[model samples]
Target: MSEKTGTFLVTHADEGSAVFRDVSDGQVHTMASNPDVAEQDVLEATIRPQPPMEVAWEVVEVAERREIELVDTDLSPTTQAMEIAAEQEVGDVERVERAGEGEVHVLSVPPETTEDAAADVLDDEGTIERAARLGAVRVEVRREEDDGVLNVRYLPD
Candidate 1:
């Protein structure tokens, strides 16, 4: 068979190989992949049929890759909002105060924001960038019941 180009959704990936499903044909193909490839990643690749089965395929080159990251909602509503805001644009975040070593608390979020809505704005690229710069990998959202004060704490992984 000849070479084909299509987008593949990675169903499984490990140090040795990866399994991807063609977005166009719903066909699953396993190929030798870089260990960095991960599940749930969408990859655009050049493929060729393998052996006797036309359904079997191998990747020639990866043209593109995309991944959707899910954010945890264990934090308080306001902190979640600020976390998303920070991810969207760290420059837009203000009143970031240091809580401890590798820890920071953000105090600028309004009291009325909902957690689910805030979680929607989170993306891996921004989160990773912010985490690397701040030297932390965990975020905690806290709210004071009496005064209605909201604080976002960034902590180590």
Candidate 2:
């Protein structure tokens, strides 16, 4: 079946990282915004839409969404890795950090958490695949065959 797909405008502001507002809901949140924006959801559900001249409302494509925060979402792969590595002495760690002011999750964490000496463990499962598992956080999947280019942005909380 074809994946449900729609377009989203990457919003950027000096106040914080970019945010992906629902093209239909007029919902706005930080790039690190959670799927459940208690505050914004309330507004979108209760408050009516108004004319903004340039735009009227926004909504995100539900099917294509793989949970990726852009700009500066909080991400913590390192801290998690530290925790996991503590259990295993040998493992590879690549990316870990806060995903802005949103929730916490272990993105691209190595099999080992704390005491790993390698970075490749970050993608034992691969780049985008690992990122896809992270749902709702921004991840750049690059050619796994080469080293460099892959990136994950999690805003600091």
Q: Best by TM-score, which number?
A: 1
**What tens digits encode model 2's per-residue C-alpha lDDT throughout 1-157?**
1122223333442332344443443344343323333221111112112234422232333334333323321233344433543444222334444444422332223224322212343333233233333333443222111221223333321
For 77-113, candidate 1 gives per-residue lDDT tens digits of 3644445454543224444545465544443334355
TM-score of each: 0.40, 0.23
| Number of the top-ranking candidate, with lDDT as the measure | 1
Q: Locate the minimum summed-lDDT window of 10 residues in model 1.
A: 116-125
lDDT of 2: 0.32
Q: Tell how far residue 81 is off in model 1, in angstroms.
A: 20
Candidate 1: what lDDT? 0.55
